[model samples]
Target chain A: MHDNAVFSHKVLPFFLLAPQLIITLVFFIWPAGQALYQSFLIEDAFGFSVEFVWFENFIYLLEDPEYWNSVRVTFVFSAMVALVGMILALLLAAMADRVVKGASAYKTLLIWPYAVAPVVAAVLWWLMFNPSMGVLPFWMDAFGYDWNHYVNSGEAMTVVVIASAWKQISYNFLFFLAGLQAIPRSLIEAAAIDGASPFKRFWQIVFPLLSPTAFFLLVVNIVYAFFETFGVIHATTLGGPGSSTKTLVYKVYEDGFVGLDLGGSAAQSVILMIIVITLTVVQFRYVEKKVQY
Target chain B: MVENRPWLTVTRHLVLILGVFIIGFPIWIALVASTNSSSEFVSGLMPLWFGEEGFGNFRRVLTNEERVLGVSVSASWMMWNSFIMAMVIAVGKIVISILSAYAIVYFRFPFRKTCFWLIFLTLMLPVEVRILPTYEVVASLGMLNSYAGLTIPLIASATATFLFRQFFMSVPSSLMEAARIDGAGPFKFFKDILLPLSVNNIAALFVILFIYGWNQYLWPLLITTDENYYTIVMVIKRLMSAGEGNIPWNIIMTTTILAMLPPVIVVLGMQKLFVKGLIEQEK
Candidate 1:
């Protein structure tokens, strides 16, 4: 890309890149390589003994019910989170787009949640549905409905999903609003002049044009739901109520650290690494396509 | 407006108002909870209005030296740690990423593409994926319970590097030619021309990276073993699980509010830059 104008420095470029490269090698590449290596080795509970068992960890994971359950949990949680987050954000963004006044005010109010840490978001929701002194539970009691997330797996999943999705709405809303604003206003005016209602205009003109953004956000939101929501689940559910909310990532931590199943944990880490690589590749590919359009 | 639709305009405002309320409901509850006494929290549902204990809760949380979950550090100390960690990570990412991006964009070095790809590979290796081995590496290096441990591993950002790279590529080549003809060295040109031009981008990236650094939970949780090294975000979870009935909800809520305030202020204050960084980073 810089074929025309170039800087000729032999050692300077290396000097410039040294800090990042050292950190990446030390923190990222080396550890990832270790994970790959350790995934093939089964270690005993004690630190003394280890055995190389190629593909045995993967085989064991394949046969393990908890691993499968975690896979199921991650998918279900991610689906619900992406769906709820995208829908709510789209609705709010559409509304914000239509408003002539106080649009920035609405944006300011809605976007602050993006700054709230996921764990803090979890705490806020946890306090709200705390079951003992929670307002939601207190209100639900009048309707003969229970709101305790402690004992109920479904309720626990719902809590984590809502907290995760709530934290993501601000991000999705910002993107959707940008996408909406980027669409030519003349298109909407022309559609309206043709007697198309606002609903028809949105679907026929706006929505289709916003597909690239929506697609990009779908990938991003799913990746976020997968990797970033670890804090939400950790702070709120701790994968609680018989591992009901335990995602694959959580299980990796639990198995590696708490359960001390290093082989299995490493195997899980390898799997997670593969998933991230796939998602990153997909995002880059889609981004390239969007650039072309 | 496109068409004179009174009902449509009214509906838009109504929907946006409702959206704002739904989004704000939990924070309102937290705020209200932070303002009430422990007895008030135990009596029933939390009060909707602020109580007399608001200042007291914040003061106690900030000053109390008692250990919660064996973390003897006060909330203020933890917040300081968080502030340092966030600032370091944000500044570190920006500095290193800009340098690397500049190298990649301007210099034709050996293994340049390889270096770029190596950095790109880091995008797939988040802290969560390689926690055990990374922890072992950090532990082996004896970096635990230190600021370096908390911020360094997380500082190598592919997104920031790529962003700067994109921005540099779009910069006019004639500017560089002009500088070169004026006998300006690469470093001088970078300092005088590139740095000034990149001010908006740096600010935008700072807004994003600061929030990112501030919001980090899992990494800090893994690296820090000492109470002195605890970050505000990491300690909040521990406080939540300190004890079910023993939790000082008011203080915890106050701390949560405190922990959230800075980044929220940054986002609100630099709205334009934050938005620009976010959209451009994704691109």
Candidate 2:
């Protein structure tokens, strides 16, 4: 996309582009290159010696059960978050679209959680589900149920999923609401006049029309759940209870920072970068398709 | 509007109210927790209403009147650090993005496509993915525990640049042509016409970027070892892990509220621009 009328200054454009280019090189490209280079080299204990190893770190990761566990955990976590968050947001958005009064008020109230930081959201949920003096645990105790994320792996996953999904609801809700409002009203009216129940009309007409938005949000939510929820798990669970809740990103941090495994962490970083590139390509393809339509 | 369905309307209202309650429940609990004293949580469930200790808890947390876990940084000081970080990031990103977008759109120079692709490549390299090396880079540059380390690396992303580029492409070519015919240089044209035309977009991007900068957790946590550079968001982890046995729930909750306040206010106060910026930037 180029503008026809232009300035013919040679050095001026470089001056304009210098800041962004330099930062991209120093902070983004160079670091990424280092990760790639370091992934191929292994550092020994005590930081004394370095050995060149091609794919050994990746091979080690592939054979390691712990790494597999993290992969499975990340999948489960992202799937749960994207599924729960999108469904709840869709339900709320459908109801919000139907209401004729105080719609803006409801919209305002619902979307503010999007602004809350992931760590802050985690703390809020942690306070609620705390086993000792939390109200929810107290209420559940009366019903003959125990709640302790501290020692329970499944309960810990549940806590992180809830907190992460809670923050995402507002984002998905905004998009779904915008999608719903964009459909021509006459289509729904015609379906209703043809003796279709509201439920039938929604499934037949509205849901199909909303699929593109749904697909777009699915990708966004997956990326978010994968990358952004590190803080959520870090603040509350720290991927604890025997590494039950450690996603790939958290595993990288854990290995690199806490465990001091350089090559392995760099390899993990390389893998994550590949995932992000693939997702970015998918997102861009969808945007291009939307443009074509 | 299409049919006479009074019962359906009532159901919609009921569902909406319930949804709002579920969304608000956690924050309500956090607010309630911030109001109570530590001893109040010793033997009972969390209080459902306000406690008499609300004002004192907030005052104590804000003023850093007492030391907890041998560290006594004020909530106010952390918030100020957060504000400064957010402001520099938002303004820095906007200014940089605008200049790059302008150069790409209005002028065709050698390696223009190369520069555009270089910036685009960054979309695939989030700070989370390359954390260790990025930290090493910042450390090698001696930017650790400083505002530049916290904000500059983050400002390198291409989302804002892409948005400005899209907007610039939409501007009529006749505006630039007319300005050129009137003897206006590139700088004068940009300052007089382009800057004025971009106010709405600048404001919208500012809102989104400010929230983004303020909510950053892992980057700040990694680089900032100095207590003075701690941001409101990252400091919560320290607060949680500190004070081994007796967790100061009241003070932590108070800090959580203070951390959440600015971004929530920004979102609510500028809901329209925030929504528009979000949807457009994703494209």
Candidate 3:
């Protein structure tokens, strides 16, 4: 990692690194340590008493049905988001990559949604599905079905999933498009010269070449769905309608902030930290392999 | 590109057109809702056309101070808070990360690798995972309801530092050697040569970080109990929950448009830099 030439300094380098180090220690490290430590203790809501019950929190969480439900909900939410978001983005990117004209224009239209906040996205979808005044429900009523997310748990999950996935499609599309462009043109043309049909060439060459990007996006999208979809849950469902839409991250907020269950919330945080660390490790390992290849 | 068949070209255009339409549908609905009067949304489906109360809704949402439900501040005040928070975060991250990255790249020091790893650890610990403890720390420090509470904790970014480090590594060693031969000290060389070269990276990072800071929701929600300190993004949630039927859909949509306007403008106006920043940071 060293440069061929470098400046020699003792105290100055320390000073240069001080601001970032200090902020990281204070905000990130300390809080994470506290979460780890507090997860072992059970205290009353008012902070009146505390008992060092080392594994009780973990044991209780393991046996808790609601916690298990949250895990199931999170998996479903994350899988749906990753699948829907990546498929739409892959389809659009493949199309945009094929067209020689107006590519940038199509990109501009497709990518602006990346800038819209998740909460705003949730609000947009919420407005569209608002049973009475919403356009989608109005159309649903025109058919034989009724559409109300407020009362239907499955519908609540669907709306949150759509809103979260919709905001992420732009990001995935950019990456996939970049990946598609990076594929050597000669390889595809060579395939074309070998009497391979367009669909055959794509399946045999382009799709296989795009797998790395697909895997990377899969990890990124799942992490996003797990953590960043907090806004989507907060704005639309609040994990409501009998906790049908409550993901793990949302449950942590609910139990910690609103429910005032400190020990349980801290325990949940530790679990989330483990999940994030695993995902990040997987991402970096794959990224390093990609670099080598 | 290998074979330009007319039918293939038509199919490609059709697929892209349909994708654009689906992507644009929600936004179009929001736009339509923002232009109409609230009364129009009482019993029927939302109108697709603009109504007579377009500017009236925006003006009321922007300047009106009367309490609707949970909103205690005007839309303009919330927007201002959001702007300040975003600016400080974007600038603070660049300055701190650049300095640290410079240290890691150009100089030799004790605990250098230790510092780098420590900073890298922050990337794994996002705010959402440790929200309760972080809130407790901020509360104990009495930083709640203050700009410092809103921005400082969020400014310590591992991704920004990594980006700057990657950029600094690519700079030629000759520049530094020449500057050293010219008797330019570290600060002088940095100011005269390094900063100028880093302008594009800084601009790209600024656009991405600005959107990131502006769109923060849960952190601001936890820290800012005072209505005056509420950011536009957080305040909108309050507006949504306050008055079920009494909440004006038009005004809420107007606030949504205003909230997303700055970041959207930055993305569209600086599309290239944004794409560069986004892709580079991920790398």
Candidate 4:
């Protein structure tokens, strides 16, 4: 794919590239280097004295139960978001795929959620389940079920998960719908002529063909649930109901900004960087394979 | 049409309607809440229907005279900030990305791969992960509470650059040869031929990047301590955490509606380009 017949420019190309390279160096690479350096040193209380603590910051984080809880919470939260979001989107996309009339209307109705900001999504759901004057809680009260997320850890997690997952459904649906539409119509018709049930055809033929799209969306959704959802948690729970919804990204912000634990937060940032890099690598590998197909 | 199962078709419509309902429910609730008066919420059940105060609420939120209504900054002011930030980020990202991509693809530059890899390194380190140091750097540079502080650090985009690079590579090399034979230099070819060809790609990227910029929350929340620079998206967080009394669901909902309106319109209006840019990013 390389363009061998290129212009032989000397300083012009460098001039063109300077803005991006400069910003990347100053904003991205510099700060990342600082975070890595700060992760290895512990600053004193007054911000005056500092001591190099090598692996101590990481060791302390690893030993801390709260950090472990955050890891558990992150994985659990991401899993629920990916599963709930992807499954619901797959159902909707499959249905929309099957329908001929009003498919675009259904699409227009569905994909608007992708435009709503994460914080705005949180606010929408927060209003719905407000526990006092909320619509859902008003109905739940009749069934003898309490609906407060402020006090219940599980409910808090559920609220953020729903807000996060709801915003993601539109994206997953777009991909899944595209994937579904790309499958050959004759394949399904051929299977139906053989007397295979619709359910069997879907599970065997459609789903197997859609696995590539499903896999791509899985990685994308997990990355979204991990990092892009900082606003969702920050605005609503603030990682509260006693740190129940404090995923790794939120914990990094809380520790670094609010708690002002420079060394520990930097260590956590390093870990998150590793996670993001891993996810990017995995996504690119899948994408390359997908391009071939 | 694959099978003549009538029941299955009905089920499909039903499922799609249900999905649309669930997806549209929150926006509906937000819309309904924005229409009613603040005192209406005192009676413990949320009203599911439209209220008489719809026009008044939107007018108040959109007008600059509503600062005394407990929202320190007017919704209009915040929305203006959001618009500026979004436009700056989107336009800045596109300009820088296209330039760098053109440099890498069209010309033989030294350390070009190194520069590309350096830009790629930013894909992993989002603002959320390296919050403190990035803030420190921005603050030290005297960029806090300004538009530059809000948009510049985020303008260096790897995805946009990569997208443009891929597009540039696919452009037939013969086009460049023809341009060169016609006495056009690199810049002349880029300006005349390449730019015209890339207009569609630029438009598609603009739609996606505009929504991305408008929906930014954390970065603005970090840098913009002054209410003058508060984006509409970031303002909601402050409004929610203001206090315990009254909660002001009407004004807040109105603000939420206003905040989401532009991006929602963009996404709905440019549906084709939006979807293309989204899938293009992944590809």
* lDDT of every model, 2 decimals: 0.90, 0.91, 0.90, 0.90
lDDT string, candidate 3, B1-283, tens digits: 8986899889989999999998999888878888998888776888878788778778877886355324667888889999999999999999999999999999987788899999989999889999999999989989999999999999998999999998988888888888889999989989999999999999999999999999999999999878899888986787788545665777788889989899999999999999988888767
Q: Which 10-residue span in candidate 3 chain A carries the lowest summed lDDT?
A: A1-10
Candidate 3: which docking quality band?
high
Q: What's the distance in Å from true for residue A200, model 2? A: 1.0
lDDT of 1 by residue, B1-283 (tens): 8888899899999999999999999889888878988777774677888899888788877876454334677888888988998899999999999999999999998899999999998888888888999999999999999999999999999999999999999999999999999999998999999999999999999999999999999888988877889888887888777667777777778889989999999999999899899988887
- List the candidates' TM-scores in order: 0.98, 0.98, 0.98, 0.98
For candidate 4, write residues B60-152 as lDDT tens digits: 877735562455677888899999989999999999999999999988877888988998898877888888889989999999999999999
Cα error, residue A192 of model 3, in Å, equals: 1.0
The alpha-carbon root-mean-square deviation between model 3 and the true structure, to one decimal in Å, is: 1.3
DockQ top scorer: 1
Residue A292 accuracy (lDDT) in model 4: 92
Task: Estimate, for each residue in A1-293, the C-alpha lDDT of model 3 and write its tens digit.
Answer: 55556788789998999899989988899999999999999999999999999989999998999999999999999999999999999999999998889999999999998998999999999988888788899898989779989899999989999999999999999999999999999999999999898889889999999999999999999999999889989987889789899999999999999989899999999999999999999999998998799
**lDDT score, candidate 4:** 0.90
Per-residue lDDT for B181 in model 1?
A: 93
Total clashing pairs for each candidate: 0, 0, 0, 0
Error of 2 at A180 (Å): 0.7
lDDT of 3 at B91: 99
Error of 4 at B232 (Å): 0.6
lDDT of 2 by residue, B49-145 (tens): 8998889988988888866423557788989999999999999999999999999999989999999999999888888999999999999999999
